[model samples]
Target: MNAAPPLTPAQISFFHEEGYLIVPDVFAPADLEPLRQELHREIDRKARALKAEGRLENLHEELDFDRRLAAIYRDSKENGETIMRHLEGLRGGGFHAPEMFDVIASPKLLAKVGSLLGTGEIVASSVYRIRPKLPNIGRGVVPWHQDSGYFSTHCDKQLIITCWAPLVDATVENGCMQILPRTHRGEVAMHHTGGNAGFLVIKDENLPDDPRKAVTAACPRGGVVFMTNRTPHCSTPNYSDHIRWSMDLRYQSAEAPNNVGLWPESLDAAGKADDAFYEKGNVACYPPEADFLVQSRLHPEQVTNYAEYVRRRETYDRTQANFSAFRRWPESVATK
Candidate 1:
């Protein structure tokens, strides 16, 4: 794939001033199917594991595909560790999966991100999430909160940008993501634990409305919605019969500090020079004993992939300078 087209002056201004910008057709529809297939496979695997562990009685009958998977696990202290460990694996802390790079370093998508940051050297650090709307369950309303509410970074500006992409036709009826227009320009809200599920938190107030209603991001599959880390957004609970799946990616500057203490092996063995933060923050959220197997399963290649993705992106910058037009659309459109 070719590097993405540079952002228009208007798009850049919108992103900086408003804290978000949406680009249409960042990737061809065809590029989305492989991801869709993988998502299904991963969810299926999770289902099987949950069933085996007696977390669920049956995958087909009891698994609520509409509920956000992030909130479905048991509300135990270990639950937080389980989620973090899984994220560490998927977001360049686990196996060397190309899909991780695809989402983080996608040539087309990164250009838009680069345009917003005003830099070509982009560092992507994001979570992979799935919203499985099960039948008959409330698509819990996600309280208003900025993505940075959970991040450890301390910058005057927002360091997190969320790329939300859905695998199905997202609609108001099916619990699509909702955003409050222009609210990100205000003060960053204080967050506390929310009522949605285990450990999920949101701001204390509902968004104010006057002339406008909450904008529902209901779009066809393969379309992407870009929002600021500070944007107050949430989704209705899915009562739909089908599963509504989507992924959220995080990106930052290569120079930014990352709390990657979770990846112990990624640190250098040599006399801990210049890198002491990883070990300091890498404390396990789970109990001491539960960490043995989980940490062992973590592969160091994930850290390498993230570093390399940044390097390869520079090669793409040169190519971007030469190319001026977009590439052919992907094949998913034919099916649509």
Candidate 2:
């Protein structure tokens, strides 16, 4: 396969100015077929296990990837959630398959990221999420919130890019993202916990700009929607017939504060990491997940391999250790 090209100067400028960029052809539509198939197999595998255990009645094997989960969800919300938790992990490292990692570390995507970041050293975080927004289900409908709302306050000014790529042609009908352009240059707005599906949410009054000014981020399969940590964005409800499958991968410059090589010497299966490990991890922008050096032109030897990537994510997740004690925010957003 030919190497993916880097973003042009104009594209880079636009990203800096608008706070987000939607670039098409980041990958061929077929390039993501493996991942789609793998996820479908995982769903099938879990559903079959549930059926065998008499926990679930319908396996929904006749349906394809997009509709099968919806059928299971319609039958039992518990079963639907179980499958999601298994695929997305308890945190975010649950599914660290090679296919998922291949998308995360794709050279074509990184070339554009490197250009936007103006650096050769890049750090990939384990906070990457695999989202399968079920039709008419509010589980995947995100509210307006900047990515930084979930990070530590100390990382308010730092730059951690979010690369969101859909497995299908993301259209307005299927809950495409809505981004508040030029609003990212300011501070992270007030975010309330307990948004839809446990996501952090920034209320309309707290948003930097009027929510009416937000632009629809309709993108196609193989395209990528790049946004900064401070970019205010949200996804609408999926009103279409199929699932809106997508992944939001996070990356940062190596210069940013991260836990790339700061593993605890005594992190055990029981999650007893030494005090120093927790102390060191708190300084990271997002401390719970492991961060690894994905690309390092100056220190190529330090780049993490697939095995090591799996190791780091699994190791950190196994610990289940608490890291940063971010500032407390006001609780209780009115929900209907």
Candidate 3:
């Protein structure tokens, strides 16, 4: 196999200093077309179902991919409902469309990840998100919060990398991500659940005194913005007429403790065998779905396919009896 692309010294330095990095032209049109096609297929199915149920009169088939969902919700009686309601359900904190597997497991993406991680053994995190920032929708406006705020405290020391890729050109008017420089150097800030969609957000009192330091990451199609788990970032509202389509995929070093790639094997290490762990108010990393191997130097043959991905997710849903309802930090931690 070909060697993964390596990050230049300058690029690596910038990432460490700013807590985020933007790599342009890492992907081509071909790399994104497959994922777009898959999205269209799923949207078409949803439209058909809605029409059959009399929730929609026309399928709005003439509308482009960016306008279809907005038009559907506008034309339907479900005017109060958001476009996200019609999209795929969140699996392991994100959308799990089978068609997205190709992009999720793309070698090119893994190459970039390997460069930053300095290891070929990379594990894809289960916490990936497909964000469709609809026009004039408040739900698309994410509030300031570090990615670490959503994860278990057990993984605090591990490095989790988030790659936010936009299918279309992302601009300030279309809800592109913005980040606070060097915020990763600090501890996770006090966050509360109170955004456009009840998303976790750092309280305003905890925001940096210098608000002008935040930088907007206006990326083009096929470009990606990589941020550390502790990076403080959020997106503005989508004021444009079209949907701002984007996906946030995460990766971590395979050797990291609580590595989701190890799945059933990591379960023991994550304290699945210890009932006392749960009783003591500790939660496992992503207790909802089964994570799978994406790229492994030691066991390349074991990389998960679409079929296995589905099987494992299904098995997790069926066999895992209860998911932890605890999603917030205690007052002591949040106040600190």
User: Relative to the true structure, how large is the alpha-carbon lDDT of every model?
Assistant: 0.51, 0.86, 0.74
lDDT of 3 at 271: 29
On a 0 to 100 scale, what is the lDDT of residue 128 in model 2?
Answer: 88
| Residue-by-residue lDDT tens digits, candidate 1, 1-336 | 654687899877777665566565677778876665565455556656766887654345344433334334433324324433453342223322456456555767777777676665554553435444443444334545566555433432545567877767777777788777676766555555434553234533433332145577776676677787777677776666665666676665544443233232332343121335543443211101001110111342343354454343333223222222211212221110
Backbone N/Cα/C clashes per model? 14, 0, 0
Q: Give stretches of model 2 more than 4 Å off.
A: 266-282
lDDT of 3 by residue, 1-336 (tens): 776466788888898888899998778968898788778777777678766777767778898777887787667636314336534336332345666878888888888888888888877776677778888878778888888888766766678899999988999999999898887877777777655576787765787535468899999989999999888898999999998999898888876643243334334533254564455543435656566678888998977788877666655543443644335754322321
How much is the lDDT of residue 177 in candidate 3? 95
- Pairs that collide in candidate 2 are none
Window of ten residues with lowest summed lDDT in model 2: 264-273
What lDDT does candidate 2 reach at residue 334? Answer: 75
List the pairs of residues colliding in candidate 3. none
Give the Å shift of residue 30 in candidate 2: 1.5
In model 1, which regions exceed 4 Å deviation?
Answer: 46-96, 203-213, 259-336
